[model samples]
Target chain A: MAAISVELFAYPWDILEATPERFLDHCVALGVTRAHVTVSYHSGKFLLPRNRSVRVYFPEPGALYFQPDAAAWAGGLAQPVSRLAGSGWLERLARGAAERSIELSAWAVFFHNSALGAAYPDLAVQNAFGDVYPFALCPSHEAVRDHAAALCRSVAALGIFSGVDLETIGYLGYFHGHHHEVTAIPLGMAEKFLLSLCFCPACRAACGSAGVDAESLAAAVRGLLDRRMQSDDASGGQDEEAEHVATLLVACPALAALIRLRMETVTALVKRLSVEAGSAKLAAFTSSFVGSPSNIWMEGVSPTDVGELVECFHLLAYAPDVAQVNSELVFFLALTSDPARVNLTLNLGLPLTTSFSQAAAKVEYALRQGVRRFSFFNYGFLGEARLRWIGDLARIARGDSR
Target chain B: MTELRAGVIGHGYTGKLHASAWLANPHAALTAVADSDASRLAGLPAGVRGYSAYEQLLADDLDAVSICLPTHLHAEATLEALARGKHVLLEKPIADNLRDARRMLMAAKAKGLTFYVGMTHRFYPELREAKAQIDAGAIGEIVAANDCVLEHLGFLNVPQWYLEKKFAGGGAALTSGVHLVDRLRWFLGDDVRAVAGRAGNSYFGADVEDSGQMFLYFRSGLSAQITFAFMREEHPLVCDLQVIGTRGSLTVHTWQSYELWNNSGRQRKVFYTQEPHPAKVQAGIAGEVEEFRASIVEGRTPWPSAEESTRAVQAILAYYESAATGRLIEIGDLHAV
Candidate 1:
């Protein structure tokens, strides 16, 4: 059999304050041949005293801190905690992994500048509602992309991590605007919000090239809102009042093209960033039943559409390992049965109630169907109760006991 | 002065529910019930009458009627009631499509009758409290919100009318999802300007969508994500709302409990659950009945005019447009279409 390697991915949140010695012991005990360490650092808020040659605004409440001055918002980068913790822990883990011959990857939440948004208002995503979102940075913005690249480079240079994993970029829905937070505005306000997007010259030019009539789209949304209000009003604004709201139907082909364009932009950015970090190998963990064909969220796309989306991702060269499938058992079976051509390792992470025997059965079944690798989400989250199966997993990985 | 008599058409599930609410209230008399199924209309309380045909039931001295027919016959039955000058309480969605909805609205308007659509979740106590708080600006400028409804197989039992495109305009989105859309629009205190949606029939192989997700943009620059699906087993029917603002945040869980978090003080306040106000339900029916009665009595129009219903139908059409086309469809564009 091919060498069974057990790789453990560690989240940054779990080891923010952990000592290197503690991590090494844990890794050794868990039989983790390779560990992925995450380093995340953020400052909470900044106070800008007027006439001090700088202006600052604290958009979010916690996690980001910075001094309000020219030195802070401009090129004022804080030290990454992963750099501090990994320096010592990575050495020990590296020595342990060398002796045990394990690999390591560094995990990072990519394109997320929640800290920057909180500390520096200038870097925040501004919504049409005049509210600044502190937890999200616009992927379309150049400054935001640069900041993300710098962070990626810093993590890559750590030398201890074999790879880097980036998370949560441009996944926020269409109405998210510049704010990371979701909002409830009247339906009548839709047109005003649509005008808020593509404000960046680059986005505008891109929309122009794509032949997207942003203004007309905004007006259509506005008209729909007005119609809804009028309907509700006609029903006397009563809950049980039945009122018919008019629907504005657009041609399907046009919509499909628009969605393709948007997807292309986002995927291109992802590929560019992955290649730039020298971590050409990428993995994307998507909920098993999201987007088109399996629109678990009811996002209006169909299962066939979702299959098309998966193909799109593949065309962009995203490996199957990058597409982490998530769903209940029945849905998982359905996804595996699709005719869509995919050639990546399918990682199945289900609830903890699944027994080792059952898991083995599943693994065996998947393996029979061309699955080459499998992994449990987290050994730590399993606890010590019935989670001793993790040891079995380690043995299986070592190919000595399983 | 004599108390007005009222009859309910189609005494099925929703019809029974309406009957119970009406019986508990003292505003109007439950005069009769009509159903094509004799077995369904077999039993009746002492003072109430039952009929197999709606025309025969309308011949009774009843002043108003609640048309709780299946989706396919909503327009026909409602029009019949309005033509007879009887007030109406029609169950949602108002009709199967924009054309039917408009026809119903126009007919009701031409006859100067009372027409009301049943969207009962608005009567939930927690939602009422949240609306009050929002109107008071306790949450400041509203920013975003999310609404989720999950079920394992809620659509399996949909009647044949729902399966026929000639009856149920769309699928789960038009049926169950419409509730969330209406509630979100109500809570946001604005209209839904544009919508981008994705829907599919994953669990069930029906042509209609069993699951859907909608991203709504409001006129006030507020954004929301509304998710509806038939894919959960044990989770309670949760119609929850989370509204963020400049000053505080207000969340209503399960549509009956309220929680408010003040941004400035960093304090969270939980509100007690209140009983569903009977007066509100009665008031809706009462207003609808009074409009019809007044139109007949004094020759005037109703407050919740047919023009309003036309707008709502247009909005529903817009949702279908966005869902079918996969584009952010504008609501007003439907007017010309």
Candidate 2:
């Protein structure tokens, strides 16, 4: 008498705006008992009318759905922008889901308000160097959390979705360590590379409360750097081999503590928010290079840590959309397409299932792996081909279809 | 009765700059240069001894020290120097974060040692002139200010420590944009009340941001916009400031060129004759050194004290909070932490 559980990726807003009847019928046809819907895109609506004649105004005025406590909504409400051709679309989509007996989990990408960044220059992240990254919002800002929570509440109030899935919470990169060719290192090793922790008051206070000696840590780092440079010089400076080893010695524990503290803070915040929501379950989709055995450049995380995170988030309760397992091969190939590295090339081109299937099967084979809760990147591929895999995956997850 | 001797910590770019500045200044004498990199100290100018460990450097008979190490090291080095009864000149962004910044400030204050933040931009002749003019009511009451700092990604490729979250802190905002934010806060003559910002790693793939934008709302009702990026092809280290007021507006280019526009008359005046900061490089070092010297001798307080820098730190943190949450974060919210 167990429920036949199946999770589907549904773009309800887009579907309703495009083909209301077909979208409704498709949900029924797939026997989709549950749907993970994308409530907000990076810039807004994903599927806009193909009419070249339609002029789209960003921040579509009253179109933005906010939580009750959202202070930023005052500005949004005051300005009346055009709604995506279809208004009151969520109600119709919810009705369709209800008719088909499908559960919907409203999914949103938090800390990314690309539209707001463009419309209001004040709401963007500025680097110390004075470059404004338009899409990302400050994680520590109350307004960001409040606004996001407001949006989630609005979606939940519709009586359509079962819960909300907050996708991609702490996904950020520094230009120096992540993008710059010279300083850029593998994602696994990146934690050890940066020269400063955010001296921003919030992070500093958080670190201090966590019993971290930010100054001592910095001093230790400087000491390590000094030692490394000396070692490098002694070794003829031809290679940074000695320096790398020295840095590793000093950086590992420091970086680990820093990351652990940050993760704890973030996890606690998310958990607190979820508790406040009463019924909603919070989930974070995190990308890690530590999943791969070949990620030797950086200290790989212990399997225990992985298990702890899984248990903490209760990931098993909800179906995963696409868990992209990255490794040395993927990172290497993505960085450069050198023919000399055939293994990396092959892995990059291979499917996520192939790259991680063995390890994934060993760990939790029945669980939905490499599955996305909400489609953020590569929507077209995910919508057409990936969803089929996801459906089959849901059936397998339920121990039925396979 | 005795001349003040100082040592330079971490002979990197900033360290070397500090060492050279010390050698050039009369009030302070370069006693020792301590760096782990023996090769980096190979060609030290005459009369300066290079030590492998900071302990050895601290043992030297020095009245003060300039910490030109990484952002994370500023607090530790400065604290050690201060604990040794040495006045300190710590580099900008103060400490890696606010807690460390406060600790450094408190430590220095407790010891009655002169501790000054190396906010070099404040020493720029143009900014100084601009500040003076604004204070004199030449530009009238400040209404708004905007700063854009764009540079090539080449600078992002420093040591790995420059990118690590533990060391460098947050990406562009902490490393490069801090200068702009501090300058804006200084020029506005008020503290940043609230902030909304966005940051991400779209460029290289590090966990920190390569490009970011921040909005700062000063307590004085003056708002400022700052953009920090490593995406540009050219390394254009431009700190262009546009200060608007009810009477007129002033645009500063290169911190030297000044253009003033009278709002009522709709007339513009371009002044290209003013000389740039004469002791620009030495200004921060000299001012900090003089303060340290005076504090050690005359028992006076330093300018741009650690407490003042804390406000700047809070402003940056507010921006980060806004960036992470995609909402307006008040300065009080940041201080609450």
TM-score of chain A taken by itself, candidate 1 = 0.59
lDDT of 1 by residue, A1-402 (tens): 443444455433232212233344455655656565544433333222210111232322222111122322343244233223422334544544555555666555543455555655555544323345565555555666655565555555545556554444442333333434443433322222232232233433454678875445434544554555556443233222211111112333333344444445555555555654564244333322222222221222222333333321111111122122222222433654542222222222334234556545544444444333344444323333323454565565445554
Maximum-TM-score candidate: 2
For each candidate in turn, the interface RMSD (Å) is 27.4, 27.7
Candidate 2 local lDDT, B40-132, one digit each (tens): 576566789999877789888887888877776777787788888878877777865777887887898798777877777676666677777
- Each model's number of backbone clashes? 77, 85
Per-residue accuracy of model 2 over A80-179 as CA lDDT, tens digit each: 2224323334554565566556676666655555555565434444432234555555444455555555555555555556667654344233321222
**Using Cα atoms with residue i matched to residue i, what is each candidate's TM-score against the true structure?**
0.42, 0.43
Give per-residue lDDT, candidate 2, residue B298: 68
Residue A166 in candidate 2, Cα distance off native in Å: 69
Highest lDDT: which candidate? 2
Q: What lDDT does each candidate get?
A: 0.52, 0.54
Least accurate stretch of 10 residues (summed lDDT) in model 2 chain A? A341-350
- A332 in model 2: Cα distance from truth in Å? 47
Model 1 docking tier (incorrect/acceptable/medium/high): incorrect
Over B45-98, each residue of candidate 1 has an lDDT whose tens digit, in order, gives 568899999988888888778788877788888888887888777877787676
